[model samples]
Target: MNQYPDPHQGEPWQQPSGGNPGWGLPPEPHTGGQLEPYGNPTGGYQPAGMGGMPEPTEPTLDTIGDIAITQNTVITPSGRFPIRGTVWTTTDMSRTEQSTPVWAIIVAILFIWTCLLSLLFLLVKDTKTTGHIQVTVQGGGHYHATQIMVSNSAYVQHVQQQVNYARSLAA
Candidate 1:
């Protein structure tokens, strides 16, 4: 003995006749669901309000000056005066173990002996020296000074002090 009535036949809410299955209400009208295009749809996707990316602007002399001082370099452009700063000094050195030229080595190996050539190579030394300096200006620019003689550590310290002074002047 079945205690529950058959679902298809006994429930008034469950109508065998075609009708609303939920809440006994007529179905909502079919409305096409598509988002409205933002900005120019033909132009492709963009933020809802903004038209497009802002245009790039040219850099001014003040901007260029700031960059020059920050990068420690001078900027020279056509129809504009070159900007520079006070000079400082540094050094570059190179040492070579094998001082003899290739031809000398070949001739020595061929005529004299490899042992004598090796001895000559050991006796001679090759050294090169180069120097640079630092130049800095107040709110204008800073750069390493070039074409200067080898500077002692004292001179370098002085230049660094000057650079610090110039940098402190910037607002």
Candidate 2:
């Protein structure tokens, strides 16, 4: 194979004028290239800025509202304790009250031709939740408890998830 371009006859594959068509040069970056943080595929590509790529911001603590939890530290308005082992407990202080809705009473009164069958609407009970759940987390050398207002059972579950994450961090 001929390594050098023939001076007498220009070859179609050969560059018009260049040293091996940039083969010996360093790789050039693509203009406005995309970047994924920490090589995580799910992080997605961020647009390259004129100032270049920014440093990734690692969280010092995982936070849930006012509470910030780390592997060895728990921070809250009450205080910060360097916890070694963590324990979590939740007290369901919430209560749901059962009552007849006004709409049910109205339906029963408006459709009384069937009498007993229509009155069955009055048996429809509407449940309303009231109160809060007391989430208490205590371990190592200190304890902190907070009350989260409960609008429904799902809200309590959300609080529980937060507590669970904190517990994992504390551990």
TM-score of each: 0.21, 0.55
What would you estimate as the lDDT of candidate 2?
A: 0.70
Pick by lDDT: which candidate is best?
Answer: 2
How close to the true structure is residue 59 of candidate 2, measured as C-alpha lDDT? 52
Question: Could you give me the TM-score of model 1 versus the true structure?
Answer: 0.21
Task: Report the error of model 2 at residue 1, Å.
Answer: 99
**What digit string (tens of lDDT, one per residue) describes model 2 on residues 45-89?**
443323675524335566554666766666666655564676778
Model 1 regions more than 4 Å off: 1-100, 114-118, 130-132, 137-171
The ten-residue window of minimal lDDT in model 2 covers 49-58
